[model samples]
Each structure stands twice: as structure tokens, then as C-alpha cells.
Target: MTSTSTAPGAAAGPDAPRPAHRETLRTHHGDTVTDPFEWLRDKEDPQVIAHLEAENAYADARTAHLAGLREELVQEFVGHTQETDLSVPVRRGDWWYITRTTAGDDYPAFTRVAESPELPRGAGGVPAIEPGELLPGEQMLLDAQAAAKDAEFFSLGGLAPSPEHDLLAHAVDLAGDERFTIVVTDLTTGTVIDESVTGTGYGLAFSADQQWIFYARVDDAWRQHQIWRHRIGGDPSADELVLEEPDERFTVWFERSRDGKALVLQSSSTTTAEAWILDLADPTAAPRPAGGRRDGVDYTVEWAGDRLLVVHNDGVEGFALAEAPLDAADSSAWTPLLSAGEGERLLGVESFAGCVALELRAGGLAAVRVIPRRADGSLDVEAAWDVDHGGELDVVELDTNPAWDSPALRYQLTSLLTPATVAQVDVASGERTVLRLTPVPGYDPELYREQRLWATAEDGTAVPISLVARKDVPVDGTAPGYLYGYGSYEVSIDPSFVPTRLSLLDRGLVVAIAHVRGGGEMGRDWYEQGKILAKKNSFFDFVAAAAHLVDQGLVAPDRLSAEGRSAGGLLMGAVANLAPERFRAIIAGVPFVDALTTILDPSLPLTVGEWEEWGNPLESEEVYRYMKEYTPYANVRPVEYPAIFASTSLNDTRVFFVEPAKWVARLRETVTSDQAERPILFRCEMVAGHGGRSGRYRKWEQRADELAWLLDQLGATARV
Candidate 1:
């Protein structure tokens, strides 16, 4: 293992070899190699030979172990995997059920079950029924499965009584390709209400009366998305384009006011976001600016009665919730209802029954804040509930996908030392209840605890790290660890629950989340410091965190595994290139390793939009040089790297599947050591994009594959 200092600015010893200067090589296939480590040609060096031998031995052992467990993992996942074929549309009352083909080559089927009034329940209770189960009052529609190789439910929202009037929406690839076609069906009469008369639709919103539907469609060229409004049971000609964003780099998100009198269109360009409001009463009316734009404001709006609740940065560093009367035409009329202060970073907000409920950071801790609306539109501070302690809080955590109703919010919270717990917090009483605390079946939470530590980056910036391990693991500290991070896009990888993660934890493995720069955990300033020219900070921060853990006796170098996805994948790849001996296994999912080449390609979906995140390579030579410096795919060398698993989907539009495909191919061909073991496995979701598949079953299958791979690497076994 390579020994390094945890403290910033620590000088290397005189005996330490001077690092080599590397150059990148560009191939005719449009791929670029940034750091070709030519100095490693003399592999006879003791240091190089030792590193290569250890890596080869580990790889050989892992290969044999994985071969033995592959069949068992597959069989275990298959049995535990539940079939999800029923569709539950948003209904008027308690229950909303629809039919779907469950198993075998049987005909398309139907079923009925009560929908959970509060949280979204899985299809565990819904029983499979034949066609005879359909009542005369109920109706069914099965579109001719032509070119519908993977026809499945997209989204089941808002249902009407009659067959001709019921609204069922889904994004399907009727062309038998990856491009999606938005389809809205009237299940009552079994007819297609709308089938994306325009181009491919991405985001959808329906008016309160359900008469008007607003959606954003993606097209080629300048205007990537156009927001259009269509009336139900109306002619296609009646549909009108409400907002046309001519800049292909911009994306639009629209939401109707609670009363449906106003529509808010948030136009997001590369780095900036601007919102505009339109009067639905007057379709031809021009949209008025909604609020002032902040440099790193990722604002989301919500409506409560006659007022609009804005979760935005009021030209401040962090986020806060503000409010303005819906009747106010001027954006300046918006008033600061809540201020962004220490521990007041607003994470989420929901409006219910004339009250605004919020999830925020208070006192450097995760907490809930509520404000009740008065008759005149002003708000009164209702209550505040602290979810976790400031010291115990994982600063870089985010909520597990939450499900909420009007009066109660249901969500799961997980921290470094804590298993995920499904909790329900009542708005009125400020009472918090834990519904389900994630358990490893036999393992106990009392045995594991999380420790929060801080390390300094090369620039003396304080980086936070969360380390989770079994309590029995001696503080004298000899433990294997898995470090994870995704320090880009200002995204905070907050603590969340994953059952598969238990496979590592139960085996006395320590899992750590490195809250590196380039993420939103510390604030907008932190993100700005780690992106673009300062992007190298992300790599160094991860390395510093790892060193901190080892210095603190939490783990040894050879026992650590590094993992990341997408931009985080880029982080994993770059760190591996910089210090391969620090980790045992590296996992890069849908990795954007070939950053320089992808940025230069205009044909990619989000390439132009990324100029704000990664800077424009086409226009600036400086950016071109900096991007090449950290581009993972461009930095591959002949040195023996840790056992690597780089995965990508062929249908992924955001990062382009070819980046990983090209990267793995190059790694396999160029690398000299079979000991490094570049297992470039490509799991192409033949049916989906960016996000694997639409159905729950399809997603679990993917998860199973990932878990199997992780288990194989960690030398852990899955629960049978």
C-alpha cells in the first residue's frame, strides 16, 4: 500500500520517488488518453513489481471466488424477486387497480386491489385475476402490442370513472427503439387519448380539472424542450406551445398552481435557473419572471393556497424557503419567510391544508420546520422537529425517495452509523414515528456505529468524512473499508438505506462516505471550489479522506474498495489512475471516464448542457487542457490497476453508453498486466435509458446483478 500523509501540504520523504510527468494519446476512434504512464516501462522496480504481484493475486482469487458464488446469487435473487405486473392509477377514493401480464406466455391479465392511502405500497397483496374479473362497470384496454417489444406502464396518474374519460399516461417506445413516445390512454373506453402528437415528451403536469395537460417535449437543435398544453377530448390543433426555449442547452420544468389559475415554467440553462409564470386564463399572455436568479440556486416551487412557497437561495450561499402571494405580479414582491442561516439549508418542502412543511438543516442537524398560513396569506411558525443530532448527522446525506400525503410525510432517513428507518412525521402534532427500521435480519444495530471525522484537502479546505463499522470492530482499528463518493453537480450523497449494502456491513466491513468538494454538502461555495478548474480537488479530497481513515486506524490501504457512478465514476477512475494501490477493487457505473471526447461531441444529449459543469471545451483552450488533465478515459495507463468493473447501458442517453464501451475496450487492449483484471462488463438495458427500466421487477434484476458483483468482490455472501 502507498503511504501518504493525512495532513495537507505534507512533503514527501527524500526516499520517495519523484512522480512522472504523463502525456495523453488520442486515437483515430475519437477517444483520448490523458495520462499514459510511460515511466512504468521499467516494471522490474521493486515497488512496481510488488504492486503488480499483489493485484494479480487478488484478481485471481476474486475470479475463482466469484465463479463459485455466481449461480447461488442468481438463484437467490430469482426466488426473492417478486413479480410486479399490476398498475395502480391515481383514483378518486381509496383503491386504484389495473391489469397487467404477470408470468408465463399467458394472455394479458387484470387485477384489483386497494391502494395504500398514505405511502406507496408494493404489489405484494394484489392478486392475479383472469379477464372474467373485470366487472361490467369497469373497462380495460390493451393496445395492439405491435412494435411494443417492451410495453409497460409508465405513470398511472389521475383516473376518471368512465372508460372513455379515464386518464392513463406512460412513456413507451412504440417504434421498438430507445426513443420514447408518451402515451395517454382512456382505459374506460380502451382508446388512446393522446400519443405524443409532438416529439418525445419528458416531463408531464396535469391541471386540477384534468382538462388541460402540460408537458415538455425534447427535439433536436436549439430548443431541446418545448412546453405545450393540450385539452382532453379536444382536437390536436387545440394544443398550443406555451413556452419555446430556443437554446438547446436549456431544459424546462412546469408546474400548475394549486388553484390551477397559474402555471410556473422553470427554465434551467447550463449553470443558471430562471422561472416564469403564465396566467392559464389567458393562453396567449406572456410569461412574467418569477424570481431573482442566484449563482447556484437550484430552486423548486410549491403552492399553498393564495401564496407561492419558493425554496430558493435569496442571493444567499445556501437554500431557504420564501413565500410570495400568487396575486403578486412582480417577482420583487416575494418576501423572505425563512432565512438561510447556520443549519437552515432547506432540503424539501410540501404544502398541505393551508400549511407549509419543510425538511431543513437546523443547528447543523437534519430537522423539520413547519409554517401555518393565516387568512390574510401571512405565515405563523407552527413547529420544528429535529430528526438527528448535529454531531451525529452525516453532513453529505440526502433523503431516500420520499412518499407523502397531505398531513403526514413518510420517508426513510439513514446516516453513516444508522440503518435506514422509515418514519412518519405528523405535521399537526410534530410527532415522529418509525414505521420500519431496516435490519439485516440477524445482525443488530447495537453492534455498529458511525464516526464523523474531518480531513484537510491539499488547499487546506476541511473535508468531512463519515465512517460506518461494526461496534465490535476494535477502535485499535484493523478493518477493511469501502469508500464511496460522487463529488459533482452539487449533488450530496446523503446517507440512505440499501439492503444490499448490509452484505458488506454484516461482514465487519467499514463503509465510508467521503464528503469531498464539488458536492452541495458544504454549500454552493464548496461545489464551485470543486468543479471545472478546481475539479482536481474532488480527487485529492477522496484521497485525503482515505488517508485520514487509515491514519485514524479505521482501515488499511490494501483493504479499501472505491466506488462511484457517472461523474463519481470519473472520480473513481481518476483516483485509480493517481493512486491504484490505495484500493483493492474499483466500481464505476455508467462512468463518464472519456470526459474530454464526450464534451467535444455536440451530438450527445447533455454535452452542451455540461459546459456549465465542466466548462466549454470547444471554445476555450484552457478548459480543453484542464478537462484533459482529469478525464478518466483519457488518463488510462499501462500500470497494474485494482480489479475494475466499469458498467454502462447501451440505451443511456445522458452519458452515452459508448463512453464506457470505448473505455473498457481500450483498457483491455492497452494494459499489460492480466493481474489488473479489467472486467469491463456491459449490462445494456435493451429496454431503458439513463434509469435502467420502468418496472420494479426489471430494476430488482439490475440491482441483483450489481449486488452479486459487489458481493463477489468483497468476499461476502448474500442471505439465502
Candidate 2:
């Protein structure tokens, strides 16, 4: 593949040509003090007006092309997989059940297994192997006959009660566009008493009585959702919009207090959010603001009789679990039960068997059973369980989306390392039994290892990178390494197991996750350093980490590949443009490469929300000029570019597919690389959104395609 000329001050190859532009781009957004909109506001100068109009026109055309490509890609990828749904929901008799659709089927079958059990013993005093198991050290081949018999799993769904009073379980149904549905099951009769109610959007919270269901639904305009309440067993037509924003710009998130007396919701306007409380009895009552100027708050509500235990942000850093008298109409009645700190956040709360259980994260997962102050006015921790896993429990792998039946204490205890199977902490006996360790199939934990490494960026900031590879791989720096990063939105990329990733490591690949700035790895400060005017830090940190790997002889430039998604896609595109020779191949998946144009457009879902990450171009000329310089699509020049694979989704409302589409198109037009040999493939998923596909098999296929592309670039092959 032909490579681009090195920028001024950039290390150059022996044969590489130097670029004319030697100066690095300035990215200070605050330097331009004057109104950046002055150019648009004053159209008297024909040259300025013409330039603005041309840029606007180009942006509009690109957006339309992207939208069209999204639709086309969705259609193309839809037929590649059979319909299948996967879900775990609590059934009657407190049994946890999993439901899944048969290949090519629309409906799901459910399976029920006791939360506590032991396999039947076998001959000769040796434990017998179950249908799903094989002899020790042997590969467990899935039994076709057993799979057919297990097809009855979905039938368990039919056994749940559709009760008017029972709290419904939320199930994510994949056959229907992967939407979540709420259904109430009768534990006694083993039948569903209520029909499934489709969820509004992503979030869902149930009321105390199980009659009222609170959820957020998307409307026509912006991507924000309005909180709605639906009564189970009541007329579906009677569903009420409990809370909504008249202005389309703001978004609201709502949840019910454990007692169901008050509805707590957060209304966010751009970067700021305000919490509000509404009386459940009086739906027409105006919501009272709970706090002010709080950037964000993590909370959960639990009921202790008539009072509410609210884990709230008290206009301070971190959070505190407090108590409030719900009997009063005033929100001021709330009082803090526990102090807030830099690392304190409430994970879950459970009130069962006349005991109030709370799970908190101070240093590690801490479970404390609280005895509400009797009429005597004294508080005490009835029982406490401090999860001392010695950091062996990988908190990064815990699913952010908690299960419906997730215990207030046990969930917090096992909410790490790929979702613990069962954390059986007996409050009475103080005995704990962890059942069925969650396994990343195909991964031998003994053969793999994880380590934390820090790389110093150009700005002298230490960027933490997580490295995971086969322990068997020689440290002699000969392994093919893949580095990944996403440094936007203060979203921390935690350590999670991906089965496909193991395939790469098994093939002598060293995978590294660069925890760069503009991410919340080290908390808010780390994020702030890499966003807005400091956004260049994100790019620089990634490049620095890649350089560190090369300098350390962990991987050579020609053997290293960088992979990123969404904003990380922007990172991949920028690094590939800024230092194309450093990476062997670039996989930019569902990228936001056309950052400048997308930020300028008001029609995009994340445009307004993104002002915090990428400064408002309309408000500052410095931001506009800086973004224009590094904008992936705009930055593609006539040079020998690295081999690229840009993937896009047709239905992604966030980070629309057009970004990658336009990027690939621009690279094809600008670069002189051979189409066949140094291919820049544009693989668009026609039916999927931000997530490629719904089915496991389909996702595996996409992973295979991606891995195949990377291996092909590295001149490696999947061993048959």
C-alpha cells in the first residue's frame, strides 16, 4: 500500500516524502473570543458567504448519502442470519429461567432451572456428566437430540402468570427488532397472566404494586424520551404520559421510588441535568426539583415502609444513600443516611423477608443489611458483607444492565467478572456458595493473562493501557499486536471478555486496550483533559500508546493494527491519517469520521449532546478550524494510505453510517492505493444498528469477517 507523506517533525521512512505543511494545527477553542457565528450572521461578503454555503451544501449532501447508505446496508445484512432471541428472567417459585428463539423462528422457548441445585451423582462414586457436559479435559459437543429437547425452554414463558398484581419481568425479545417487553408471570400457576407490553426505548422501572410500569419512549423529533406509565391488567389505552418535555431539545429519565409514592426523574439540557420528584397519587402535580447544578447523579430507590431510601447526589462529587419521609409533600424531607465520597455509589437495594438490604461500592462491593431506626432514633448495620476478592473479581466485565431479579446484595457481590452465576450469601448462616462460574467459552483462563501498562503522552500525561494476551506468547516482542481505544463521552472502556478476541490471541496476537484521556478511566479529570479544547489529547494519547508498544519492541509498525468504534472510529481515522505508516491496518467500525459536518448539523441524534466532547463549531471559529484540520474525511490526502476496513450500520441513529461511507468514498477518491491489494472495504450491515446483529451466530459471523480482514492484512489465516 502507498503511504502518505510525513507531516513536519514526524519521523519519516527512508523513501517517504515530506509534506509541505510543516506546522501542527492549533486546537485552542477559547482563543477565538469573538462571535464565531459572525461569518454566518453577516452575508455581505460574497466570498465568506459563498464558502459557508458551499460547506453547508457539502455537509447536507454527505448526510443524505449516509442516510441512504444506512438503509441499504441494513437491507443487505438482514438476511444473513436466522431469527433468535436470548433472555434470562425470573420465573415462578423464584426460579431463574432463560428463553431463546429457535433458529429461523420468531417466538422463543424458555427453560427453568432451580437457582440452587446439584447434578445427580453417577456410577463408581464419580460424578455423572450432564447432557450439556463432557468428561474432564474433553470438548463438550452440543447434543442435537438434547438441543431439540431443550427447545421446550421457550414453553416456560407460557407458564408465567399474567397477574394484575404481580410484578412483571422485563424480557428483551430479539425476534421483534430486539425490543424489550414487560410481562407478568404467576409464580403459583406457572402461567403468564399479563400480555407483553412493548418498552418505550431503553430504560424500564417497575412500580411497587407491580400495577404501574414506568418507561421512556422516543418521539419523532430529537432522540430524547418522555416518561410514560402503563397500568398492568388495565386498559392498554389508558397508558398515561406522566412526564414529557415540551421543548424537543431536552431529554428525561424517570424511575419510581421503591415505595411507588413518588416518581424520580432527571431532565437533562445538554451538559447539565436536574433531578425532579413527582407524587404518584397526583399525576397532575408539578415536579419539584431535588437538587441544583449537579453534572450527573447515580441513584436507586428502596422502600422502608412509608419512607423512601434514596441514593442521590447531594450537589457534590460521588453519591450518598439517603432517607426521605415520603408521607410529606415536601422534597426537603430527604436526609442522608451515608456520606458521599469519590468512590461511593449505590448498586442495588432489596427489601425482603422483613429486612432491608443495600449494596454499595466504596472501595469494593460492600453489602450492608440496614435496620431502619426504630422509634428510638438509632441506626445500625444488622449484617455486612465486604466483598474481598483481592481484585480477582474483574469489575469491568460486569454487565451495566442489571437483571430484573438481581438481588440487592448478591448482585453487587457478583456484579463483576462476566456476571457471577450465583452468589449465595446466606444471611442466617453466613455461608456463601458461588455456583457456575461464568465462562467465556473457548478461553482457557490459565493460558491467558492481563496486565495494566502506562504510556506517557506527548503532553506528559500517563495514559493507562490494558494488555491481554496469551501467557504462552513470548515476550520477545515478535507477536502481532492489535491496539484498541475509544476516548470520548467520559465513557470508560472496561475489561470485558469477547470470544472472538480469544481467537486472535490464540493465534499469537497481543491485544492492548489504551485507556486514553477524554475517557472516565481515572474519573472526571481524566475525561476533561481529553475533551473539547483538550480533545487533541485523546488522539495524542492513542498515538503515544502505539508508539510505546513499538518502542518497547512489543510489535513493529508493520505488524500493529488499531481498531476502534464510534468516536474511537474517529481516533482510528485520525491516527491513520496523521500517522498512516505506523499501523499495518485500520478497522474503523461505525465511525464518526465526518465529525466537523455532523457536529454542524442539528438533525443528528448526538449533535447537541456532543457539544461537551467536541466544542460547538457554530460558537467558535477556533473549534471549526481545528475540527476541519483533523476531520477524517477532510484530512484524507493523496498518499499511500494503510489498508482500511470501515464498517457501518444502516439503522444506527447514533454515529450514522454516512460518516464511514463518506470517509471510504473520500479515501478512495484521494488515495492512490490499489483497490484489490490494499483494499479499503466498506462493509455495511443492512439490518442492524449500533450493535451489528441480534443473534449470537450473526454476531460471530461479523466478528469472523472483521478477524478475516485483519488476518488477511497481516498475511495470516484461521487454522482449520
Candidate 3:
């Protein structure tokens, strides 16, 4: 698809191409709805492909003026980033694993070096390395750039080294379909030994003996429902089926415990979960249940020394910590180690030989606390203390402390202005040392500032907003602002650093994150208050956030823009309908705009499993009506809307391209707004999936395009 050349500030090009409409009747809960654009769901239809391509051409024509700006932004990203860099090495077994990236390569190379007395731990128990420098005797494990050289799209699913560190089992997806193939390599000889497993999910674990590897397999609906054990260098057809989840709502996953003594197999739904323990010593033994699955109770188990550390949300909304003996790890054997706090959410627990790190959230920010361990490895709760982050908005969490016996704890810290930093703390003496700060060649943190603001929702609930901009940017109402949000599935959109965002902030734009409901930022109750029957709260909360910014005289409403992706994209659609006049434009990426319809069809990927998050509309009349009230596609009326840009990928299994394609079509036909002034644009990535692109450069290009369009809409295009 090609577009006609259009100069900056040019008139609308040849009227946005419109797709043909065909009605399909969808009946659920005794209600029949006519979906005019439902035919777009058929990806195989030639007409559908043509219509999408036409939309693509139109979008390209409309945004052609931003070509220069896009290029400049891309350059800014490249300049700010240290093109050739090395990640802080992580120690596991006898090796120090390190990832390296070259100046122009799109992917990173994984390699490891054997531990030795010559290469001692530098400051804070981390290796001292400069940019592009390699540790001595470093051997190549996987060169992602080399592996992705021939594929249009490539994703690394899982990389697991055997306990003996002789075999490396890795999974790769070349089609962006999320189905991966497991390949085993003899690390000692640098040769591939097995390519026998295919159509598997994203996790892999090896038996302690290194003879077998366990992986998950997805069903036709794209749910990971089966766990299989494949012998090293054995035929895929003879792989043993370890377990299969019969319930559609549940998905199976397995991971090696922190201690590396057992493989923890988990079967989880949105609101419930259970785990099985497979002793690594006996890979063929029957799995032992840690706890029985109870409705509405979610828990995760990790082996900690002689006991099991359990983080569960049973009697507590924000979750609590419990401990059980490894021999009798049933629910009845659990005893409280840390009781639930009123305003704090216990996210998870990571155990070390000398201490346990509790990753938790409190006051709308992430923090970590360390509890000293007794001589026998049980947590000494009375001696616990929270880590001192020393920054107002710094987000701190436990990093990869893979070795159970390490005396120090590694944690990462970052905020809106600060780049990512890895630091370690001595558990016994509480001595913190800065290990390595991610190298950003030309970034100056001093030029940026971060602030926290709370906006009251319509129901009197306070939503937190994190704002970041150039230090010189004023708080007056004249500046343009971009608000972002994602409030679904308890996923918290924390304040973190992004180098590319510098392009926006440098241009005098204020970028903010709305920590609204349905997110785990506050706690479990925070998420519960915004999902299912209360899902509309997410939309209202976001609209309220925009209104708060305008009312606070921080940003001009007419110059404000908003963006969200996936579920957040759902937020964008809902708010565009709920309060179109509150902003200048909206960008929805792989948006779940057609929520009710997708959730009603059980055959769709993630549909049946989403019943707990979004109530089942097929079985409940109330759910049908509730979803109908705010679902973007069904609620589109002949009302004015902000300039809308929706992006989707053809192979996106999570939020199918049809959702956005249909939503954009409805908006073009139904909105009463002037198409020339507030044109609705849709871009479909023909060769991509849920995430638009794979390689770093291609991903950055997509970002630059979106940012350039947003800058244009906000009238902040001129580089400051």
C-alpha cells in the first residue's frame, strides 16, 4: 500500500477510504445485536484484506507530513541510548550470564563466563565492565540477532540452562503467533542437539539430572493447557504428558523454584490457582499438590530451604505470606508468616539463604522489604526492615538473585527521570552499594523532573497520577499534555524511565501516567473496584484524570492528548465516547475495543479465561447490559469524537486486529464530527502480532510514528 504525498498542514487527502458494511446478527442472553462490520473478523477474506490495506494507505497519506519529525525522534532515541552495551551479569551455578548488544544490531546476544578468582566481584558484588567489553572466557549461548536474521518476526520465549549447565534449552517463535519450538543445544560443544518440540508455550525447565526438559503446550484456543516432558535428544512424538488442565479457564505453567530443588507447576485462572511440586531429584515421580484449588483464592508457591513460602490472597485482599513444611505443604499446614496489612499489597516473596525479600506495594508505589532468616532458613519476621530507596518516586523491586546462598540482595530502582539502576544490599549489615546504572549516552536526568498528583474520581475515590516533564516546563494551563493509562488485570503501570519519551518532554510536552482502578498499584481491592460489574469505573477514572489535569491548570484541554494499548486501548475507546471533548486526540494500539463480543465467543483466545475479569455476558443478563453500556463498538453514537488513531496487528492473538478494524470503521461512519478536521485513522500491521514489531529499530520506528502524530494533534510539533 502506498500513499499520496501530502505536505505539512495540507488539506484532508481524498476523503478517508470507507470499508463495505455487512450485517451479522449476534445473539446472547436473549438479546440480538446487528454487527455491521463483523465480517472484518474473517482474516482470510480477500475483501477484508483489501479494506485493511485501503485503511493503511489512508493512514499513511494522512500522516505523511510527520515523516521528518518521525525521523528526528528516531534519531533522538538512537542518540540517547548506548548503542553498544552490556547488561549486569547474573550469577547462577558456576557461570556469570551476561547479555550484550552491538551498536547497530536489533537483538542482544546471550553469553556466559565461568566463575574464577581472577574476575572478582567489583563494587557491590557486580562485575566491573565498560561498554561493549566482554568478560574473559565468555562463551556464546544464543545470538538473537543471528537467529532472527532470516525471519520477518522473531521472539525468544524461554531460555533455560540445565542444572549441570551443560545443555541449554530455548524456545523461539518466528511467526509472532506465541507458539514456540524448543531447541536444545550442547553448551559444551556449541551444537544443537534437539529440535523435537513444537507448538509449545513460553516457559521451560529442566530436570535436575539434565536428562529431561519440561515445557508447556497451548490448546487450539491459545491457552497453555498441557505440560509435557521431553527427554533430551529424544523424539517429540514420545514426549510424556506430565499434566493437562481440563478447565478452559485455567492455564498450566511450570518454573524451577528459587532453590532449584523442585519444579513448581501452577494451574491458574483469573481468581483462583493451585500448585504442584515435582522434586527435581525424581523427575519421573508423580507431582505432589501443595494446596487444593479454592474458588477466589490465588496463591503462588516457592521452595525456600526446608519449607515452602506461600503468597496467597485468601483472607486478605492485598495478599499475605505464609509458610509450610515441605513434607506437608497442604493448605491446612500453612501458618501465617506475615499478616496482611490494610493499605499494603504483598506482591511476592523471594527467598535467599540468609534473608527473604518481600516485593510489595504501598501508598501507590512499589517497595521491597527484607526479613532476616534464622539459622534454619525460616524468616525472622521481627528483624525485617524496608529498603531505603531515598527517592520520592523511585520504584524499587528485587532483581534476579538466582543463587539461593548469596549473601547480598540485588534490586533495581528507577523513576520517571532516573535511568534503571541495579544495586545490592548486604542483608546482615544493611549496607547498600550501587552496582551499575544503565548507560544512556546523552541523557541528562537533571533536565527532567517528576511529580505525583491525586485526582478524585466521580465516586470520591482518589486516583494517583505520575507526571514527568522537562524541569523548565511550567505548570500553567498553556502547555500540551499527554495522559496514559492501563487499568486491567491488576497490572500496574509504574513510573519508569523510557529514553524515547525524552523526545516528547524535550518538546515541552508533559507526559503523565494515570494509576487508575483495576490496577494493582494500590491493592487487590483497587483492582476489584474497577473490574466486572464495576468496569465502567476505569473509563470514568481516566476521564476524571484528564479533567483534573485541565482543572489544575497544568495542561490545556484543547491541546491534551491520550493513549493506551490492549486493555488500556479499551480505556481510550471508552473515554473517547464518554468525554470526547476532554482531549485533542486518542491513540489506541491493538485495542480491545470489541470487548463484549469477543468475551461472548468462547472459541476466541483469552475469551473464556476473561470471565473473571470481565463477567460472562453469555450467561448473565446484567453483565450483557453492563458491557453494552460502555463497550466501545456498541456505544458508538452520532456524537463528536476526538481525532482517533487505532493501530492493530493482523497476527495479534490477544486483541485481534478485527476489533480495531471494526471500531475504526464504526467511528468513521457514526461520528458526527468533521472528518476533515478530526480524521479517524487506522493502521494494520500485516506481518506483526500483538506487539506491532519485533526488532528494536522497528519498534522504535512505530513509536516515533505514534509520537509524531500525537505531537501534531497537540500542536507541539516544533522541536524545542
Quick one: best TM-score, which candidate? Answer: 3
lDDT per residue for candidate 3 within 1-720, as digits (tens), equals 112233223436767777776889977777889988899899899999998999999989888777888888888899888889888889999998888889889999999988887885778756666667776788999999999987889899999888888999889988888889999999989999999899999799999888999999998889999998889888888999888899999999987887778988899997999999899889988788997788988998878878888999888768889999887556898898886577899988887789888999977888998999888666889899998777878899888888989999999999998899999999989999988888787788888889999999999999999999887878888888999999999999999998888888887888999998998889889999999999999988998899999899888878889999999999999999899889788899999999999999999997889999999988899999999999999898898888888999888889999999999989998999887768788999988879888988889999998888887777777756
For model 2, the superposed segments whose C-alpha errors exceed 4 Å read 1-199, 204-213, 231-238, 246-249, 256-263, 269-271, 277-315, 318-323, 327-386, 396-408, 412-431, 439-442, 672-675, 718-720
* Order of candidate numbers by lDDT, starting with the best: 3, 1, 2
Candidate 1 Cα deviation (angstroms), residue 71: 3.8
Candidates 1 and 2 compared by TM-score, better number: 1
lDDT of 1: 0.60
Query: Which residues of candidate 3, in runs, are more than 4 Å off?
Result: 1-11
User: Which scores greater on TM-score, model 2 or model 3?
Assistant: 3
What tens digits encode model 2's per-residue C-alpha lDDT throughout 518-553?
A: 876665556678877888888999999998888887
Q: What is the lDDT of residue 363 in candidate 1?
A: 34
The backbone clash count of each candidate, in order, is 12, 24, 0
Worst 10 contiguous positions by lDDT, candidate 1: 1-10
Alpha carbon lDDT of residue 617, candidate 1? Answer: 79
Q: At residue 213, give the lDDT of candidate 2.
A: 61
Q: Can you give the TM-score per candidate against the true fold?
A: 0.75, 0.70, 0.98
Error of 1 at 167 (Å): 2.7
Per-model C-alpha lDDT, please?
Answer: 0.60, 0.57, 0.87
Quote the positional error of residue 677 for candidate 3 in Å.
2.7
